[model samples]
Target: MRTSRVDTTIFGATSLLTLALGGVAPEQITVPAPVASEDAEAVAGLWLSADKTVRLRLDADWSYLGRVAGRHRAAKGTYRPEGTGLVLRDDTGLRTPVTIADDVLEMAGHHLFRA
Candidate 1:
């Protein structure tokens, strides 16, 4: 008989994980980490492309979706903080670096303003 590995993780203000094989006692894993600070949480919001042609919605869940004006959705991706900026990994597997300061966001050759 082959045993399978099971991993379960719970994240938020608290992070806990359980892992083990079927019918076996699960081992607990504790990782020390901050849930999500308000400053980092600030990234969750809407942003507009400099050309005023695109609007991107960033959710707290790391979902990054964008839409073009009067057209269909454009780019979709996930983002995580990298250094002082953020890196956007699109559906195409492209990693785009983004920098934000104040109310301005610079990414993918376009300047985005908070919307």
Candidate 2:
């Protein structure tokens, strides 16, 4: 498993940027996480909707925004999967709890914004 320190740029809810390790330019245009393996491979992509909602894509980059009508509405932070939940770091660097199961995510704070 490659646990190297990668450059992760956190954009607010309005814009999004792709992140990659070392010099390996992001092959895809979305943020990915490790799935069914110890190594961080491209599993799924995440993004916001036109109405400011959070959405997750499988095996592809974010295509468009989502509708804003969820618990994570107007949220912003750095998201990383941890076991059965996602670790969401808000703009203030505060760690918020987020649970992801069956392709649906539940959050305790507003963290559905883009990266």
Q: How well does candidate 2 match the true structure in TM-score terms?
A: 0.34
Off by over 4 Å in 1: 1-40, 68-73
Local distance difference test, each candidate: 0.71, 0.45
Q: What TM-score does each of the candidates earn?
A: 0.58, 0.34
lDDT of 2 by residue, 3-114 (tens): 9898887664333323324434455334434343332233345643334544533223212222346555444544565765556565667775555444445555434433
Candidate 2 — what's its lDDT? 0.45
The candidate 1 region of ten consecutive residues with least summed lDDT is 14-23
